[model samples]
Target: MVAVSQNKSIDGRLVAIGCNYEPWIALLEQSGWKTHCCYDLRTADSILEEYSPCICVVDLSNNDFSLNSISLRANKTKQVKWIAIIKKEQLKTDAIRQFINNFCVDYFTVPIPGSHLLDTIGHQLGMLDIEASSWVEITSQHDMGLFGESKSIKQLRDMVRRVAMTEVNVFLTGENGTGKELIAKSIHNLSKRKNAPFVLVNCSSLARDDEKLSLLDGTYRNEEGAPFDGTLMLDNVEELSKELQDNLLAYLQAPSCESLDEEMASDVRIVATSSADLDAAVANGDFSKELYYRLNVFHIKVPTLRERGSDIFLLAETFLTKFAREYSTMASTFSEDSKQLLLRYSWPGNVRELINQVKRAALLAEGNEVKAEHFDLPSKANLKQSLRNIKDEAEKDVLVAVLETHRGQVASAAKDLGVSRATMYRLLNKHNIVPDVRHYNNGYARE
Candidate 1:
């Protein structure tokens, strides 16, 4: 294997341990990287202390490469760019896959292409260069509105990518304010018909059955007189009037309408979103079963914010970064206590609610860090917090946590909170968190 020197001298050095050096070394040397290699990691600690590698290549597939030892090393030197090489079958385990994602820059499975490996390594190195140059400047801009890196979110992203590759109709199902419209727009942005119209019409907003049908029919013929052939997002599909539903069924079943030309008929992609459980609604006679089945052809269920608990922090941090800039606030993070409170609370409104709260806290924060008091959680109600009222502050925290747990169900929250129902009612009135009588069921607020 030939050895090539890097253009910029790597001060921290590069280390490869227990890797199949014959193949990767040839590629690395060809790519002009001179790395220090070692088969034994027993003296890795001393070697790391001496060399302090900026990059570490650990081939976990090798029997000699101890996963436990590598994990320890990774924890000690978290800054290093660790690249793991393994067999494809090893990735089948969720734990191993997650561990790699959490710790490594990337992974290369068996049957590796030498050129692809070089390209990936080069790309990762380039990213490091970019990151070190001006991290704040590089990361500050925020137009990519999607958030979350949880396993569920990763799966959702993969699903979105797959759906975006096609021209088929997509049915997005989730609770209200779960960003169903955002998902639709994402699909449109990624599709071949991106340049065309991305129309959105809330089925619930239509005044009458005719109005619902006319909404699509009107859009079919654009203002420029060109047939609108893009993405059509029918929001709140469950709320579509019965006649409108029948018309939609007819369109999906037979896109070749006599009034439509060849180009207009084939170009449009339909995406429908519903906050309500349409399948359950259909079974309960609240929605048409035929329409429900038609829409369910390609379905995606967006998880609620609470369901993705770990993602809350990422979303909160993202919101804070934006709000800090917009509000000209110096608050860069939530206080430790505030962070615990945020994680403990259940987000009924999903991502939308998190954004609202983060923006509010950022604006209201008196210092560089957002404090628990800045949350203004509904349970705080009207309880006046005087400088001497430590008990009130503690009570407010406890009460707010309980209310959020019950989704604003005062009596249930009070019961969990270990207070009498009467006291809970009084507290709710004082805090302005009175449970909505219309939607209360199973000790939780439906909305």
Candidate 2:
């Protein structure tokens, strides 16, 4: 066991735990991160409770790095973010991996560059400040599902709650992947008819007008043989056919009609979502005006990720935590660079794309921290180049590497790359690269 030492005070109140704190302390102090050193695990609780440091740097390289010790410290100082210093090889051990995963926020492998380590510490401190200052009071019960602290999100939550009280048809407008379906679900779950069926139909997926008319007119029943009574969500309603739109309008005009039966006449709340503007569609003569007016009774415009301000960070952290638990990985947070990339990204696909990227990153990440490259996002630096040069270079490198590995066999290389032989040949020609087939017994040669 490593010997224990009394806590030494530093200016910044950041805590460092380990016997090897001398080198790290000097480096951190030089970088303006004045840290108090605590060599004993027993004194860690008191030191943290007294200093209440937002960040703690722990040395996992010490011989005394045991699961019980780490878990004790983590349990005691639940508020502080722990950064682990470990060797790359140490991660191969399952017990060590589990301990780090359970406790650390981020980690630096041994022989870490001074600049990178400092940047990470600074980022953790900054994130802590952001979290402390931006505590938003979520007003509605369904606000947790909406997941945002921004004014726009709070206003939207209020509107959703107010609208959910009545049985009025609700129209939701937002760009694709802006959680329209989630908002619709929230409304259905919070509404008076929540105990009944909440049916969802993607209008764009219906191939024929007859199918659309049958479903919306309450003629088509789900496999469960139950009628839609709670809520009927027509997703991408702007894609409804002209005939379908007329049928919907007619149904809205007269709830009980000659063709409509008593079961179909039951009050089923309609919640429709559209990425396009129904007003513009009406002006363009694509959508029926009467139908548009009927569905536009109570409209809720879901805000995009960009407009949600600090919500991006909150959502990213939420997704990371969720996927980490799901994938059984230790990645608890993003690196400083990854966080910057997430904030700067335009998120053309919005929350859906963010979830996908985070899930994929968590499953594929090798270490405790998720890095920028794990997201597979295009480099903003090279996006302005129209992707022509970068695309060619990347393609050329792949072709050369595959060809060499397969010993100049085009068919095998093409198969491995998931490209057809013809397309591969065209790519080779475009790059002016010729494959050598001299070793072929069939005597097939390419010059």
Candidate 3:
């Protein structure tokens, strides 16, 4: 453990809980970040309190530390943003995975350079500053998948935090890809049931009904799993079957966890999400009114990407860079036309589509700049790209035919094609084609 930095003029305060990476610590110190390293969170409170708003990087790459103690400390210190560093293989363990899911706002899988995490740290600190100043007690930014300055996003973030403080059932409505599930998890993480398990039952993809759900008699029993102690998230609730709806409604009415003894009674909060309008579903007689009302105690509507104004650029850039890293591409920026098109288009698929398009663009781009044609744009762009594809295919076919006629001789091919040998080579390289010539005992043959 090391002493807290006395430097008042610094970028931010980083409380390293059980972090033993000295080179990374020195790098932060050199970069004017005040860092205090501690093992087992012994002096975490003092450092966190002094920093006013601090970031903690708990290193769980090794099995030398206790996750229980770290989780307990994190539970007590909700004000501080927590990130984790864990071994990639360690993520396969349920305990480590659950701890990361429950406590960390973000996590990095290591066997990576410490320098690679600098940008993440800096970005998180900037977001934390915005959250601290703009909204009270908004601990996680990326964790909630809500990063925007628009009024709709601001209201949603505020509501998530506010609703998280209470134990009432929450109903979330939004487009399919507007991050409704993230909102539910945020509420669960911020609520009193944070320490308990959060179970999600996706109603849309239910192969079979959960037959062991005992909700009729008020005291609920979840068979084949531990007793329900945390939040129960029913995602895509509009698709819930009639039988499941009855069971869920019964549970909502009684809302008690079955226990071996009366002293161990547990209560699980209900959080439901739907992309469709449940009110209309009820009016159309497609959904149960009782179930709808029970889950709609605190309703929240997530905003779409188009409604988020300048946030599209932020999201696009974030996804582009992220996918670039993943795929090792040179797609660093969007061309001017791409940006204009991005703003003008109404994102019906929302953030999910944006992520997919950007990922595809990044992978497709052979240069640093991505173009509108690379994106899954409207018909005009698609037609232009399709034409270009046709031209490329024709050109490649012509090149192959000429090369075959010339018996794979660059000089003969260049002369026959009336183009420079350099151009011929470039064409072959672009199409990723290689021509071979074979020699026989009597004559020459092409292979």
- lDDT at 156, model 1: 72
State the TM-score for model 2. 0.52
Error of 2 at 4 (Å): 57
CA lDDT of every candidate: 0.69, 0.73, 0.74
Q: Candidate 1, residues 1-447: lDDT per residue as tens digits?
A: 111225243433456677655676777776567655545665556655555335666676655655766787776662356778788889887756876976787888876677877776666666555434432332232333245677776667657755675667899988876778887887787667777878898787875544435434434466766666778898988887777777777666664656466655435578999887786788778777877777676789998887788888988998899899998999898899888878877677888888899999999998899998888664332323332365666766666667666766666776787889998877656545546544444222322
Number of the top-ranking candidate, with lDDT as the measure:
3
- Give the per-residue lDDT digits (tens) of candidate 2, residues 1-447: 122222233222456776455565566667655444445766776777776546777777755656677768775563466777788998897877876776677888887666777677677777655433332222333224588788888777767765775789999999998899888887876668878777888888776545544554666676776555678899999988877777788878874556467765445789999998788899889999888889999989899887886888888888888889877999987899998888877777888888898888898788899999898787778544535776788988888878877778999989999999999999899887788767444222334
Residue 248 miss distance in model 3 (angstroms): 1.1
Question: Model 3 clash pairs?
Answer: none
Global Cα lDDT for candidate 1:
0.69
Tell me the lDDT of model 2 at 115.
75
Cα RMSD, each candidate:
11.7, 24.6, 25.2
Best by TM-score: 1
Task: Report model 1's TM-score to 2 decimal places.
Answer: 0.54
